[model samples]
Target chain A: MNAMPAREQETHILLVEDDPADARLIEIYLEESGFGDWAIDRVQSIHEALDQLAEQDYAIVLLDLTLPDGTGPENIRRIKAEFPDQNVVVLTGFDERVFGLEAVQLGAQDFLVKGDYDENSLAKTLRFSIERQNFIRRLEETQKIARIGSWEFHPDSGRLILSDQVLYLTKPDDNEVKDDVPSAELNQLLRRIHKIALSGREINLDTRIKISGHGERYFHVQCRMTRTSTNQEIVQGILQDVTDRYQTEEMRKARDLARKSTEIREQFIASISHEMRTPMNAIMGLSNVILTGDGVQGEQKQMVQAIRDASDILLGIVNDILDFSAIQAGKIQFREEPFSLRSVCRNLEQILGTKVKDKDLGWKMHIEDQVPDQLIGDKLRMSQILFNLLGNAIKFTEKGQVGLYIELKDRNAEKVELRFRIEDTGIGIPEESQQSIFEDFNRVKYQHKTYEGTGLGLAITRQLVELQQGQIWLESHVGVGTTFYVDLGFAVEPKLTNGHVVNDVLKSSEGAFRGTILVVEDHKMNQLVARKTLERQWPEVQILMAENGQIGLDMLERHHVDLVLMDLQMPVMDGYQATSLIRRHHQARIRQLPVLAMTANAYVSQDPQLHEKGFTDFVLKPFEPEHLFARILQYAPLKAIRL
Target chain B: MSTINTQIDLEYLDSMSGGDTEMRNTLLHMLAEELPKEKDVLAEAAERGDLPAIFQASHSLKSTLAYTGNTEAIRLNEGIEASSRHGLWTAEDQEQLKVLFERMDFLLVALRDLTSE
Candidate 1:
């Protein structure tokens, strides 16, 4: 009676009974039992009961043990399965008291025996059933929303009392559940609880369990020892599923490891390449100095030329590795400046013409008349793309003609796309291998013939082309020929100017160039190479030397130098710190002085903040004599030549 | 394992209705009218080998048999209900159902005589 709804508000009841006479007897009992205020609706079978339940709310459903559609405890299960929140009081006969208890275990709130209970007992049962069912439903909803379950363990009995939520969370098969806990996961949990009870200590931990249908899941468990009102020691705890958050943390850790390994690899390659370049600079620079000097005739000159050629190939391999690393690190930069297409072609012809002639192969250079002479783009990268393609064409061809054909593909007021075709009658590439040709370190072997070069040429070429928003592809026949086509767009320089064309003038002004240059370098051979190379190019110029940046700074203080050729990676002070000092010098003249960085570190060349670091420009080491001279002539204030 | 010494016991109804003989007669008449029809259902379901229907019919009869204090019929019907629930109607279960039907038929005749009195 205490749990019953107030008389002012009518409680609706649904009676599912197949017998009309039995239903009417229950109605008369409800009225006699002081529940006349309640509205009772009757349905004959489980099917009709479900329809009525769906259409309305009921305070309680008095279900007969056997209906036409379903019978026994299964009727209660079917109804509760669909409407878990519904309060059902199983109505059984006097002889079926055992089944009435079974129905309660199967999720019925309570049960009644007909003709055995008085009106007062019937009223009390229905009222208490509704109240108990509501409490169970609230607990279920709370557990589902928070993904948490609670449990109590008794150490003496080795017994566990798990809430309905805990049973759902463990999801044990009917056979796997023993002593009210799942076998595998429960054994582990019981061990922990036993430890907690023995030590009388609270424990917080994470544990992993392999559920039957669900894969491995992680749980956050917190438990402690406590005593009941009866002084019985027990362990109580809560378990929360943290699988999603734990898996995310694991993925983040894996990604960080991958990124860290890539960084270490790039650093290793860079240091190795830097160490190799210093010695190589001495080899290439000193060799050029030897070849350019006035010396003995025929055989001696050719041997020195061979040494120069071998060193050139070695240096090319080193540069290719460094370029590939730079591309992998996403550090390659393109410069937009005014450069003549004609000059780039002329240089290519001069470099490749000798190799073509040596093979007794015909060479052809044709330019479409409509193609512009001047264009604005990254002049260095453009030249590298053309050089890589032409070099490969010459290397693959045996005796056939190597040709470069250029034409204007499309033009606008601001930009023009130029198409370059480098064709060779060589051992052509097969169609099957063409798609993967542009992948890194891929080299094609035709008839078991191996070429002597790093396999990064075409890969670097494609990267450079794509970086500049251009397209490159090829057409080839296995025995007939191979022709590579490149289509690149560039901003047109409306008027030809005096930008990179000054390089031609610098070539002619060789001995006419004069300046007092300071070379700050740590390596003895590199210092000797730099001094001799500078002196050979400009016989009248004076060259000063320093082993480190500190000495270089002192040299700048004592001498009136035109330019400082600073080498990075020195003993006392590096080039970056030395340049900072020079830029911030006490004297206005030193602060205004130009410093050209000569570095073996390829990363320094791609640094966007190079100028901000107080160096005017940088030249990569194993320096080409012509490129070194060009940088020198550009920055050094020569007293003799104004231009 | 209580034996059925009498065909009917009004002690349960007497306690519920406070010894009202009129109400007891009305309930007995209702049981007499419903028990025969339910017994027919159980027999037809057994003839057709329908286990679910047999379970339902026997389950329904056990309650009405409790009002008559027929412990033997109740026990037999419970056995039939259990076998049908397991989806099996073995030879023993069929013999039990036969005994249960005979007991119900005798109970129905006894209820008719009582209602007439």
Candidate 2:
């Protein structure tokens, strides 16, 4: 380290001139001047001067204009161009000011006549030239970092000045030097900073600086105060944006967040596996007991019923999971129409009442008189919301009463609002879990192991409620009770009671065409359910059943059928094929006969396909009685059969 | 920490309405209610066989006994369960009878309450 700063030394010089002599004048001049504490490399000829300049960093170079190898100002020009940063003074025998000026203009610091010049004047010129150059270098450096816009600030203004390259690189910009700034943001940015300064608190401001050339730049301004300023206040520190630096930081943060969520999801999957397998094992064990004890006596049948109920609950939980994913994926569609609110409420009540009794908790419902007897909306989504709320009230409360209170509020010209409040008094939701109530797969904090649920109920409820332009919220105390509220809005369409709603739908829809019915299904359970429900509706109708698409085609070719209830997935061939074939073959009224598809797969978008295949419509495999009944009245009518 | 229903007063267990007649049936009933819970505790212990855990399980059993009214049976089993809990039991396998007696008494009480309800 000779390069260790502050330890470096300036070079000393020897100016050799021999001409009566410019040599004496040069020596005297450098000795007297002491520029930047000193030094010179002087030679009469090019050869010696080259050797000395090459040896060390010469503080200054004194040249004799008249040299043997390079004569006149030619020598000055060559040396001047080469060592431009080096301090050099021109010396000549004649006062040829023009020649001296020419040498000076070519890059020499000063020029002198060999006979006329004194030591002080020559030294002054050399000293001034070096000082001016140093100042210029410092000024150029200060402008570079200050040219970039935007900065990050500390909440408290604390500055730790260090000997880092960045420290010297960063500097304030002088408005005079830079002309290409976004004039608009200057006012806003300053105002924001000033507002922050007045707050006397910590804040991180993201400033988007739109410089003229660079379209837009983002900066994080973190302001911090170290100690008491004038009035026991803190110092605010700003960390300027290095967007180039921030991109990497943002990417790192995103990866970290992704990792955390992935870990949570993995944990959720693990819990699911445990929850599913354990219950299945229980059901399997119980079923074995029931089979073994077959017709034993009083309690044995009860035990069997209990086991069946437990399995049913487990199935329902799994269904909740299916619905949760379906809703989030936007696969759950609304079947728009009119339905009776009272009947829906009664159905929900029957479902909930038995559940509360099983848990040994009280169940109560208070319906508002003003609630329109019936309203039009998506009954499926509405039922999901209602079911979730009721389930929560029952699940959380083990000892106390679980009650539902419904009231109509905010009835306006445009819409009617029906609000339902559910109150439960078992284990109240924790304060921490209040925020997480409506979030997906979020159970109450300090959760119980005994309660079984998919944890998707509340999330589905929120989504469904929003879909209907309704709202849900809750209030609770730790050991007391939690009250949950739901508000639903229905449009200003004509209202119908449950009995009338069904009657009107069926009456208007039923046509005058009695046709033979064809049912196509592969799964035994679905097929049985479909057959039983259809039989209950139309007691005396002749029926033709097919297990797959091929069989269904054969039956259609052979038999005379008015309508078909078709299952989409089958072992041999599918309903899609059967319907397509029946359409393509162009059979008589039998071919034109309405064919309704049954499917469980949520992804199969049936609207376009159903229309394309020339089928009348579709029904999901797990058929509801009313839905099946209503749609049936549309195609094969009782009146037509009578006629 | 020995949550076993020991000191079984067979007369009191037998007095329950519709309680199990055989000792094995009684033990099975108690096992149905308590064993599952104990297994859950063990799963969650994070560090098993610790003094704190044995004490905690016994404490939980004290309430379980109150609910089932099997006080005498709990007292009979308490000594060995507590000894084992303190890590002082020399012969661990020999304590099976005490565990059985406690379970039987507990089952009798549970069956009685269930029948009455």
Candidate 3:
């Protein structure tokens, strides 16, 4: 009452009492208590009290335990059942003081004994009850908005208390049995709480609970142990519903796992494909050496031709798998260099012309006058794209013609876009299967026969085209032909050079120049192949042999070596380490030695740092004999050609 | 009925009435009339398996018994009320209710003798 302030508006009180004397007494008490501005509405029963409550808002309701219509705690229960938010204080008879306390337990804010209280005490109880009820209401509202609840457990009393919001959040399904005992999930939670209490440590845990309407919900529970002022141990905690965020995180984790597995699979395939190449190099190189050597008879030469052809097909398939996996792993790097566009076309023609003539199919290539002869682009990839399309056309066609047409599509000062059309009169693709033809392992079935090639040819070609910022599409009609159109952009080379520069160098370095070439190779077959290929070309050139880079370095110290064919990926000092040693040698001649790296790894060959790593140049293994000889001719020193 | 065997404390009633003799006498008469009726209601509710009614009767009887300072009866009534509210009517609860009825009968008889005196 001392803390009570005078209200600007009248405070409304609804009194439900059956005894007229008790009602009169309470009215007098309020009047004496200086509640002049309070409006007191008196009713004879619980029903009348409820009706009055519905019609107007009241600051508080003073209920009687024994009413004519309702008695004991039932009167308080009835009023509360109607208006759960209504503040209620019960007035009990003198002997029923315990009933007053029971009334408070049954949702009444406070209780009073009829004969025991003075005006001031009565006023104080009513005012304090209203304030306490409001505070509880606000606390419940805040908890509801945050989707969070609070709980407390006393270890000594074995008592667990949950706030109203906690009760609502953890409500069980209607069909579930209701009992005073804790539920299984609640028991698990209690165990966690007990552990925290015993260890005197704070804990954060994620728990799953089955709720009334929601199937199962995730909750983030945070708990800590603390002692009251009296040193009573208690565990207090908050539970926040985090189902939405948890599910999203789980989905993201699943997606990431799927992507990681794909990467691992691709890496495995790439390594396997790479392993296949070393043996492939031996097969192809040994077969080439056999075909080029002098043979006894016609059947022997024909048998060697079959072996060479089969090896070529197997090598093609292996290369296709390697390239496809590399592209999938995002490891393909395109080189921007200046090269003659016409030269790329000439090479493609020379490579495929014999097959076309043997099949009785006509071959033609037309370059528009406006198309630049020299351009800056990945000349190797551009040649590969054209070769794949033209090769497919020639393989599929039994007769008729295969043609390549190149024309300038668009031009700016910096770059020019060239459109290429490779057309062939072959067994054309069906319209329905055209779109998926470029997908991996999609082979065209024609005349009850699958083509004898890896299905990755077109797929690799399409990926290479897109990687170069180019587009490729095809048009076909069954039994007529297939024509693939490609649009590729390249920066035009600014400098004009004599087109015969390479030929001029070749002419100057004609005939077998005398030089001591050291071949550092681990494989005996590969070393023999290199010796035979080099010795067959330059009969006067002295060739030294070493099993590894360490042996090769030792040989270089003893002899005046003109060149080193450093084979990468060897035991006891690889090509890279050997080249680094030679480049860093004390003698100027050894440091400036022309070290050409030989590798079976296409990835290593494509590395832009190959020359920067002290090697003068690199040659891909299963080497094209002419290309190997040309690279050697450029780097190997001429031993003062005998006049 | 012997008042010594009733085991009822009058101190709570005295304190509640604040030394008002008339108020104390009126409360004793009210308990004498209401105790028997509440015990009957509790037994009937249990017989019919009406848990809500049983809870109400047990709850009211517990409060009424508190005035006599009968701790045993109050505790038994509280247990019965709590179990019934959860829709549980176990054999122990039935036994407790029976004991509560006996205590109420003794309390009612003692209240009647006091009122007459």
Best candidate (score: DockQ): 2
Interface RMSD against the true structure, candidate 2: 17.2
lDDT of 2 by residue, B44-89 (tens): 5313545455444443443234324354534433543455456664
Misplaced by over 4 Å in model 2 are A1-307, A323-338, A356-370, A396-405, A412-414, A423-450, A475-482, A492-518, A523-544, A549-565, A570-597, A602-643, B1-117
- Candidate DockQ scores, in order: 0.00, 0.01, 0.00
Ranking by lDDT: 1, 3, 2
Per-residue lDDT of model 2, residues A1-643, tens digit only: 0111222465454453535345655655666665445544446677677666666665556677777777667876666445545567777667577788777656667777765766777767666656665664464345345322323233344322211122222313323322222245543564466456657666677666665555665666565444443444433444354666667878999999887776555444433433343223324233433333333347755555655556557656755765675575455666554666665665666556667888898878777878776576766577768788888778777798988788888788766888888898968877888999788877665554535676788888888888767788999988898998898887657653211214222342223234567888654333434554555455676667887889988888888776788876554676777888877676555555667776543333325565567656565433434445545654453443433
Please give, for residues A1-643, the per-residue lDDT of candidate 1 as tens digits.
Answer: 0123435578778889888788888777788999657877888889988888888789999999888898889888788767766899999988888889888866688898888877788888988987787777787679778878887777877767666556666774423222334547756775866686569778788888777877778888888888989898888888887878789988898888878887877876786676556545655675677677764347766665776688789878987998898899887888766766776676667666667888889889998999987788877798889999999888888987999999999998999999999999999999998998899989898999877778899999999999999999999999888999999999985542211122322322232556678899765545656877888877887889997899999999999888789987565687889988988889977886778888877677566556556777677777777667666665555453444
- Cα lDDT, model 3, residue A117: 95
Docking class of 2: incorrect
lDDT of 3 by residue, A240-332 (tens): 878788999999999899889878777556544544454455445555555665632377556556665776787778778878878987889
What are the TM values for chain B, all candidates?
A: 0.88, 0.41, 0.89
Q: What is the Cα root-mean-square deviation between model 1 and the actual structure?
A: 39.9
lDDT at residue A138 of model 2 (Cα atoms): 62
